[model samples]
Target: LKYIYLNAGKINYVSNLFFFQKDILLILKKYLEKQDTYKCFEILKTFEKKLDIAFEKEFKNIIYIYLVITFERIEKGYVILKKNNSEFLKNTLYYKVIQKDIFKNNGVYMYEALHLSEYFLSGYNSENFYEDRFLIDSFICKLLSVLKDIKIRNLINNREFLEEVIEYLRAAIYRVKNNFILNSEIKLDEIENKIFIEILQYKIKMNTYLNEPLRDEEFMMISRIIYKHLIKQKKEKIKLKEVIQIIQKNSKNCYSDLIAKELLELYPNLIENDIDFKKQLGLLDIVTEKNIKFTRCVDIKELIDLSFNDLYDNSFIEVEFTESIHKMLEDKKYDYLDSENMIIFYGKELKYKKELGVSIFFNESVMKIDNKKIKYLILLSNVDEYNYLGVSRDLQKIIESVKFKELEKLNSEKDVMRKFEEVIQGGESGF
Candidate 1:
């Protein structure tokens, strides 16, 4: 099959010959004078320069048509809504084009221009297409792991069918990114294999950067593809409810492990020097297994200063190490403080070096951050940066627990660690 780039000349040749008029363009120009139509032309020029391909007049005209249509629709309170695009592309050319100063200066029509640019660039950007294969490979590996049924297992053996699915997904992701509606005649109820549909949805959500739910039409299209090549190993019909219940029960148990494993797999280099990762799983004994110090401090800075010595004593971090941690705390102090006047400083940036340590600083007197009183400063060295979600989940339980009150009565370091562990473990803190 040939990859042909169609333009308006080929699409509207007959209509153009019959009803072409330049006076219509004059009237339309006045109507769209305030629309910033020049922004579309500028974006197209940059796209052409970047791709090193000259666009014919016909393609440019089609893009102009798209721009006009977008404005007319938006006037009627219509806007395109779809899932986010691939992070790689979004960070690269797509970001550069849209973030231009000219585009941002009252260039409302650039929205449609951006979508039209992506439609062509996604196909023409060879570098992105090459890099996207790694993402696709990772996705397929996850897909195979999720679709464990024996009948579905055989589906991967068909190379043709597999390639078709891959192409379908790539196109679907681009369409969703460009806010192009996926129109399908098929309905979700017609799909017989509901379990497979759920598995497909789970895989897409896990693998891609899509933050929104897929439209039913999109799922219907995907189901049609899978049903086309699906082969049954057994004639016996199984109850859908029973199968779904079983899957859900097992999935809940392994969900966290799956997420952690995927994170480790995706970023092995970041975890290479991570001492905490080398330890046994669930060994985030932040209170009992690390340095604990008690001192009278009136403010967050003093508390931070006291913790630096413990940071060195416990993990042997240098001055720069403390500075980095200090900077992170200073930057994120507002966000880190919980309702219980607690701060958990754990971030992904610290995972790069061997500076892995946990320290707890208990203030004898009250400390203040942003005029709010702070009592306990739990300094967690970064294990996994993304583990903030787990920490947030556990922080709520810890803050509301009665066992946390025992920390105020502790005197010695040993007692502090013991009581702190009791308070933390009692709340079942994930960190």
Candidate 2:
């Protein structure tokens, strides 16, 4: 009975609460009195009767700690409340809307109003129709979710995005750092600065307030998102010579490791000679060396030969990632994936890296499938836009089938081999 109401979006059940449509408040109040707080959500399902103005006022009492649980659950499109325009997703009846912590009850109302506006304002933000008018809508109820998202939220309010994104990030890094705040005495100030520097370098937001910290859980979420996305679109057309030139010249204007990793994910062949990457984090100091042109730095013959192997071993396919998607990838949710236009791929590399051209994106926001598991990417034109959605079942298969890998696995005793070379050269191995 409750399930039918959630699917019936056109009926304004909450609005009709004034007419005694259903005793939603009675049910919620009983749950609250019992202190079985979790049931607050369960009570919200009673919109089975019809919506009334009182229902919105009643449900807005929900709180925040449940975001971790609720955000993931909403992807199933719950038999839930009418949480309109919440990018945070699966709006809690009591969930409050705070922009840097302010009580804004009407934002949800405004968000719905905006959807109505979009009907006349085509190509602005998409909308759904209700009766004779276009209705603005999102199921998530957090202001930050609706206003700050890269896809649907207003660009003017990106601060909200940064705040939310950083919060998620801070939580993750904080967990990694053990709950110490940024700049606290217990943590490394250098790493904090690195985080700040990267955010600033990427122009994530003007040097406003520090972005919200990502929790370990959220960081884990983003990391998974990045990994899956990179797997689907791993194509790097930038010539080896050009990459080598950037590193050799010691140019400061080089792509970040995020770009490098994504490109490498596409052109798994580049790993043949990218020892600097193996040795350095993000290839920070390695991609830059004075007097080295990418073309002139090393012999491409070895790298090229590796790429032709039917079995790719040199690339990071087997490579472990201590690297993060926090700096490299974006969060993609079910709403983004539900749109059928997104494309998916399994056996190919991205045509281009982050700088542009034939890029791949993962629908990193993981959701349950038949009480099982899946890692998927939604291949599309712009990694950020809603242009397409296609599923890629196995990115490694694409890499393997494309004949992308070239480097053989390094012998753990490769250093021993180097020592042998040193002995042959009349040098000491210090043995």
Which predicted model would earn the best lDDT?
1
TM-score of each: 0.39, 0.18
For residues 1-431, could you state the per-residue lDDT of candidate 1 as single tens digits?
Answer: 01112253222222221123445555554666556555556656676676566544544665556655665676787755442343433445654565463245335544543554465565443222322332343344345445544246655434435566667766766655556675535555444457446665575544452333445566557666666656332233443334334556788554443444444444433322111232212223333434777778876777876776676666635555556556555544222554566665543234333444566776777766667778887664544422322333333334445433465566678775555455556742222
Query: Per-candidate RMSD vs. true structure?
Result: 18.9, 24.5
lDDT measured at residue 237 in model 2 versus the true structure, 0 to 100: 38
Clash count list over all predictions: 0, 67
Clash list (residue pairs), candidate 1: none
Model 2 lDDT, full chain set? 0.27
Instruction: Give lDDT tens digits, candidate 2, residues 1-431.
Output: 22112222221223333223357646644533444333433333432222221222211232211322343354455423342334432132223322112223445343332322222122111111111010011111121232233232222222223334433443333333333333332332443344333333323222111223333333234433333333333544345445656675786766555445555555754342232422101111111122011111122222222221211231222111111111112111122222222222111122221211122222223333323222222221112211111011121123223211111122223432333233323421110
Error of 2 at 425 (Å): 35
Residue 130 lDDT in model 2? 13
Q: Report the lDDT of model 2 for residue 153.
A: 28
